[model samples]
Target: MSNLQAVLKQYWGYDQFRPVQEEAIRSVLEGNDTLLLLPTGGGKSICFQVPVMTMEGVCIVVTPLIALMKDQVEQLKRRDISAAAIHSGMNRHEIDITLDNCIHGQTKFLYVSPERLRTEIMIERTKQMKVCLLAVDEAHCISAWGYDFRPSYLLISEFRLLIPKVPVMALTATATEQVQIDIIDKLEMKPVRVFRQSFARANLSYSTFLEENKERKLLQILKNVPGTAIVYVRTRKRTKELADWLTKQGLRAAGYNAGLPFKERSDRQTAWLKNQVRVVVATNAFGMGIDKPDVRAVVHFDLPDNLEAYYQEAGRAGRDEKKAFAVALFNKIDLEDLAENVEKKYPAMDVLRRVYQSLANYYKIHVGGGEFSAYDFDIQNFTGTFGLIVNETHYALKLLEEEGFIQLSENFNNPARLHFEVDNRQLYDFQIRNPEFDTFVKLLLRIYGGELFTEYVRISESELAQIYFVPELEILKKLSFLKERGIADYEPRRDKPQLTFLTPRYDAALLPLNVFEIERRRERDRQKARAVIQYASNKNRCRTILLLEYFNEMDGKDCGVCDVCLKNKKNEPRPEIDEELGNQILHYLKSFGAVTPRALSQIFENVAEKPFLQTLRYLIDEEIINYDQVGKLTLNSKYHS
Candidate 1:
C-alpha cells in the first residue's frame, strides 16, 4: 500500500481511485503544475485532497463559490481533517482566526475565494504559511473566453507570486480548448501537465424534443422514466408551480430555489437526496456540490444559454454509471427567448451607470468610500425605491460584477453563532456576579459544551427558547445582554444576499466601465446562445456527438440510444418487403375471415417488426387486405369473390 492509497483509504474509505484520478494525483504529488479536466462527479476534489494530506504544508484552494467552499470545509472536517474557509461574508475576527490557524499549521486545507486572494491580510498570511499546493477549482473562470468569466479570478496570478515554489493544480469540469489554453497562460503555469478525461458520457442518452404542449410532454416523459429525477426550470416561480402540479398529479415532488428560507431549502434538498421526494423541480441554482448518483433523468424545461452549463447540469445524472436520460424540451418561443436574452444580459451603459449610482446611494456610500465593504442588498426594495425595472437592474448588477466593481452573492442564510469571551473561571465569576443569568449560562454550557468557550459555535435561538421554556424573543434579549456585558460574543443570524464593493465608490459618469471588453463578452454570449439554439433546433446530428464536438472532443461516436439515432434507425431502408410475405398475410386474412394485428404479428414472429409492418402496409395500399369496422384485418371483398 503506497502512501497515496493509504491516505485515500484512511480518509475516503475507498480501495482505489477513479479512472484518471490516481494519475492526476501523481502529477500533483510529483511537484508539477497540473491542469485536471474531469467531468461533473469525477471526484476532482480527491485528486488534490489526498495528495495534500501526504505533503508537509497546508494546501490553499481558491474557488469563486462560497457555498462550495463551506460545503467542502464541512466535508473535510467530517473526515477529521483540519480545514477552514475565508470568504466575503466573514467578519474581520473570523478571518483573523482562520488565517492564524493556517499560519500556525493548525489547518491542513484553507479554502478562500478568488477575491480574497487579493486582500492585504490574505496575502500577508499566505506568505507566512508553508504552502504546499495551490489548487484552483473552477479554473476556467479565469479565462475571458470561458462562459463564466469572473474578473476577480485574474488576481490569482498575482497571488501565485507569493507561493512561487508551491505546485499549482487547476481543475474544471467544463472548459473548451480555448478556455483551457487561457487558464494555463493566465495562471502562468510552467512545466504544466494536463489530464483531461474524455467528455463523452457513454451511459447518458442525450435527447431533445420540440413540443407544442410542453407540460403534457414533460409529464409523459416523467412517467416513462422512473427513479429519482430533476426537472429544471428557468424561474423560481415555476419551480413551485411545477412541483405542486407534479404533486397533484400523484408524484412526490418539491420545489427548490435560492430564495427559499435556508432551512426549507435544506429540508427539500435532504428529502430529495433521501428519495423521500422523487423529483426536485428547481432552477439552475440547485445542483452545485450536490452528489446524488442515482438520478435516472434530468429534464430541462428550457434551453440554457450555452452547452457548457447544459452539459454540466445534465451530467449530474447517472453518476453511478447506470444508464440515464438527459432530455431537453424546447419550442420556438424558447429559442427566441434565448436569442433575446443575449441582448438583455448586457444592459446599456447608461442603465449600468444608473444602477451603480443607485446601489451606492442605497448603501449610503459616498464617493471614494465603500471599498471592501459588504452590505445586505435587497434588490426588490432598491429597484422599487429607484423606479427601476427589476430585470434590467439585475443585469446591470451582473455587468458590474463581471467588470470587477462589485461582487453579488446569492441570498444565503448565516445562522446565529456564539463564543464565550471569558475563560471558564471568569465565566463562573460572571455567572455568580449576575445571578439572574446563572441558569441560562449553565444551560448553554450544558447543551453546547466546552467548544463554545474556544471557538464560535452555531446556536439555534428558537431551540434554546424551547429548552428554556421562554419565548424566542426572550432568548434573543438574553443573548444580546450577554454580548453587551462582554460575557459572550453573540452574532445574530442573517439571511440576505450580500453585495461587496470590490473598489471604492466612483461617480456614475466617471466609472470607467470597460466598454470594449463588455462588447467582446456580449458577442461571446451571443455566439453561445446561438449554439444553444442550434443544438435544440438541430434535427440531423446525434445529440451526444454534438455536445462532445462542442467541447472539442472530436473522436466521439454516435450514442445509439439517442432520439436522433433511434429515429434514424427506424428510417433506415431495410430489405424490400417480399411478395411471399404479402401473400401469406392476405391468405391468412382470407382463411380466418379476420385477425387482429397482434395475432398476425405473432404468426410472423420470425420476421423483423419493420419489414413485417412494411409488408402489411403494402398489402393494404394495394387493396389486398383491409380493416373491418371491428378493426380486424380481412381480405377485400373484390379479391375474395
Candidate 2:
C-alpha cells in the first residue's frame, strides 16, 4: 500500500478514499496549490489531514467559525493526533503556550481563525515553525462575490508571504463560478489544481410544496418518511414551539438553538445522534460540525435566504449514500418575508453608524482606542439601553464584520480553565508554608494531574466542590485566591456571546463607511434572495435541475422523483390505454353517482396516471360518463343502472 493509503487506514480505519478525495490529497502532496470543491459531508478535512500526517511539520488550518475549529481540534485529539486552536476568547497566556507548542513541533495541526492570522505574534511564531501545508477551510468566504464574505479572509494572502514555499489548499462546499475565480485571485494561489465534485446527489430527492397549513403538512411528511430527521425553522421560539407540538403528537423530538446553554445543546444533539430523539427542530445554527448520515428527511419549515444556504443545509442528509429526502414547505408570506430580509440585512448607513457608536458606548471604549479588545456582549441589553431595533442592529453588526471593523462570535461556552504559574517544587513548598491551603492544592493536583502545569486544563468547580465536601462557592474562592497569590492562573467559565473590535473605535460621524460598496453588496443580496424566491415558486422545471443549473452545472438530467417531475409525468398524453381500463372507470362512476376529480383520482391512485387519465378522457369524449359543470364525474342517463 502507498504511504497515503497506509496513513488513512491507520488513522481513519478506511480501506480506501472516497471519490476525488485521493486526487485532492495527491495534488497537495505534489506541492501544488489546490482548490477542492466538494459538497457538504464530502470528507474535505481528510484531504488535507492525511497529507499533513504523512509530512514532517504541522498544517495550519484557517477557518472562520470558532465552534467548528474547536470541534475539529477535539476530533483530531481523539484520534491521538496532537492539535490546538487559537481564537478570540482565549487569553494571551493560553495563545502563547499554543503558539509555542507549534514552534517546537509539538502540534501536528494548528487551527486558527482568519482574524488571528494577522496578529504580530502569530506571524512571528509561524515563521519559526516548520510549516508543511496551509489549509483554508470555507475558502469561498475570501471572495467578495461569495454569499458569505469576510474581510479578514483577505489577510490570508499577506499571511502566505510568511511561509512562501508552503503549498496552500483552499476548501469550500459551496461556491459559484465567479466566487471560485475570486477566491484564487484573492488568495494568490499559484498555478492551482482545481478538483470539483459534481453538485448532484442521485440518492437524495428534492421537493417543494406550497401549503397553507404547513404544520399539518409537516406532520404528514414526518409520518410518511420515517427515520432520524431534522426540521429547520427560522426563529428560536419556533424551534421550541414546533418541537413541543411534534412531541405532543407522539414523535420524540427536541429543540436546539445557539441561545441554549452549551451543555443542554450538547445533550440534545447527543440524544438526536443516538436516535433517542427522532427529530431535532432547530435553527440554521444546529448543523455546522454535525455529521449524522442517516437523516432520512430535512424539512425546511421556512424559506432560506439563498440557494447557497439551502443547498448546504439540505445536503446534510443522506451522507451514507442511502435514500433521503429534502423538502421545503412554504406559503406566499414566506417568499415575501425572504425578499424583504435583503433590506433588513443591509440597513441604511446612518443606522450602521449608530450601531457602531452604540457598541463603543456600551463597551465604554473611547474613540481611537479598544483595538483588539474582546468583550462579553448582550444584544438585548445593548438594544434596550440605546432604544435601537434588535434586528437592524444585528444586520449592522454583520455588515461591520464584513467590512472588517469588528468580529462577532456565536454564543459558546468557554469553560473554566486553570494553569499553574509556579513549578511543582515551589507549589509544594508554598503548600507546606501555608498549611491551611494544603488540602485544596493537593486535591487540584490529584484530580487534574500534571497537565495543568504545561497548559490550561478545563476544571469544573461543582465537581471539585463535591469531592472536597464543600460548597461550590468555596471552590471558586480558593481558585481566586490561588490566582491572587500567583500560585495558578484561573479563568472562570463564561457563556456569553463575544464581540471583538478588530481596530480602534472610530467616531460615528467620520467612520469611513463605503457607501458604493455597501450598495453593491445590497444588490448582490437582493439577487441571491430573488434566486431563492424563484426556486421556491417555480413549477415547470425539475427541482434537482434547478439546483444544478444554479451552481453552473447546466447539463443535469431531470430527477424523476421531485414533485414537479411527477406532476408533469402525470399530465402527459398516453394513447395506449386498453379497453378494460376504460370499462373499470365507467363501472366505478355508475355505482358512485357523482364524484369530484380529486376523489376519483384517489380511488384510482394505485393505477398509473397517464393511462387512467387517458381512459377517463376517452369515456368523457364518448359521453359514457358526464363531466359536469361542477367538475364532478357522473354516468350518462342511458348508461345509469
Candidate 3:
C-alpha cells in the first residue's frame, strides 16, 4: 500500500478510499488547484486531510460551519492528531491561545470561518504559520448563482492572492454546472481540474408520494422502513409536534432545533446517535456534523425550498453503501406553501427597510450610533410589539444580514458574568458583615479567581447551586442581592439570539438598498421555487433521474424502484410498442418542463392524429408517461435499463 493509504488505514482504520477521494488527494499533494464535487457522505474531508498528514505544514481549512469545525477538531484530537478551530462564538482569550498553538507548530490543521479571514488578527497570525494547503468546503457558497451565497466568501480570492504559491482545493457536496463554473471563476483558480463524481445514488430509492393524509402516510412509511431515520420539518414548532406525536405512537423520537438549550440539544443528539432514539424530527440545523452511517430512511415532512438541499439531506442515508429510502410526502397545499415561502424569503425592499428601521428603534440606538455593537435580541418580543408576522420579520432580518448592515445569530447563549465593583477590602468587609452570603462569595472567588475583579467572568449557575445546596432560582436571587449591595456587577446568562450592527444606522428611507440586486435575487429565487415545485408535483419522472438532471447530470437512468415504476409493473402491459414514437414524446417532454396532450399531438404534425393519440395512450397505459396536476404529460421517471 502507498504511504497515503497506510496513513489513512493507520489513523482512520480504513484500508481503501472512496471513489474520487484518492485522485483528489493526489492532485492536492502534487500542488494543483483542484475542485472536487462529491456527494454527501462521499468522504470529502479525507481527500485533503490525508494529504495534509503527508505534508510538512498546517492545512488551513475554511468553512462556515462552526459545529462541523468543532466536531472534526475533536475527532482529530481523539486520534492524537493536532487540530484547532477559530470561530465567532469563542472569546478572545480562547481564540488567542488557539492561534498561538497554530503559530508555534503545535497544530497541523487550522479551521476558520470565511468571516474571520478578513480580521486583522487572523491575517497576521496566518502569515506567521507555515501553511501547506488551503481547502474551501462548501465552495458553492462563493457563487452568486448558487443556492446559498455569502458575500464573505468573496474575501477568499483576496486571501488566496496573499499566499499565491499555496495550492487550493475547493470541495462541495452539491454544485451544478453553473455553480461549478462560477466557483472556479470567482476563486480565480488557474487551470483548475474539476472532478465530478456521478450525482446518482444507486443505493438510495428516491420516492415522492402525494397524499392528503400526510401524517398517516408518514406513520406508515416509518413502520415499513425499520431503521434510524430523520423526519425534516419546516419549523421548530412542527418538529416538537411531530416528534411528540411519533413518541406517543410508541416510537423513540425526539425534537431537535436551534431553539433548544445547548445541553438539551447535545443530549438529544447523543441519544439519537446511541440508538436510544430511533428518529430525530428536526429542522435543517440537526444534520451537518452528524456522521451516522446506518440511517435507513430520510423523510421530509415538509418540502424543502430547493432541490440541492433535498438531495443533500436525502444523501445522508445509505452512506454505509446499504440500501436505503428517501421519501418525500407532499400534497397540493405543499405547493402553495412553497410558493408562499418563496415570497417570504424575498420580501419587498421597502419591507426590508421598514424592518431595519423598526429594529434600530427597538434597540433605542440613535442614528450614527450602534456601529460594531452587539445586543441580545428577542425576535418574539420585537414582532409582538410591532404586530409583524414572525416569518416575514425573520426573512427581512435575514435580508438585512445578507446586505452587510447587521448580523443576526440565532440560538446564541451568553454565559453568566460577574465583575467586582469594589476592591478586595470592601468585598471582605461585606462578606464578614453579611455572614449568610460569605460561603457563596468565597466559592465564587475560589472558582473564578482574579479574573472576576478585572472583567466579567463566566460562571455556571447550576455549578453554584450544587456547591451551595440551593435551587438555581435561589442562586440567582442571591446574585441579584449582591449586585444590589454594589459588591459586584452581575449579569445573568442570556439564552437568545444576538444581533450586531455592522454599520451606523442611516435614515430608514435612505438605507442604501440595492434595488437591482434585490430584484435579481428575487427572480432567481422564483426560478428555484418553480424547480422545486416541478420536482414535488412530478408523478411520472424517475425521482433519481429528475434529481440528477437538476444537478446537470443528464445521463442517469431511472431508479427502477420508485412509486412510478411500481405502478407501471402492477398495470397491464400495453398492446404494441412503437419505439420511435415513444422516443419523440420523451424528447419533447424533456425539452419542456411539462406538456399537454393536445400540444404534444400538434408537434407530430405529419403523423395521423388517430395513431398519435393511440400511441400517447399506450405510453401512458404502459406507465412510460404520466400526467401532472393540470393534465400536462410527464415521463415516468422510474424506468431503469
Give the TM-scores of the predictions, in the order they appear. 0.88, 0.88, 0.77
- The alpha-carbon RMSD values of the candidates against the true structure, listed in the order shown, are 9.3, 9.8, 12.3
Give the backbone clash total of model 3.
4
**Model 3 — TM-score against the truth?**
0.77
For model 2, residues 95-160, the per-residue Cα lDDT tens digits are 998888898888999999898888889999998999999999999899877888988899999999
Q: Per-residue alpha-carbon lDDT of model 3 for 208-272, expressed as tens digits? A: 88999999999999999999999999999999999999999989999999888877888999999
Best by lDDT: 2
Error of 3 at 468 (Å): 11
Q: Please, what are the lDDT tens digits per residue for candidate 1 over residues 527-586? A: 999999888888898998898888899998888778898788678774478888887887
Instruction: Give lDDT per model, in order.
Output: 0.90, 0.90, 0.84
> Poorest 10 consecutive residues of model 2 by lDDT?
620-629
Each prediction's number of clashing residue pairs: 0, 0, 4
Better of 1 and 2 by lDDT: 2
- Model 2 scores a TM of 0.88
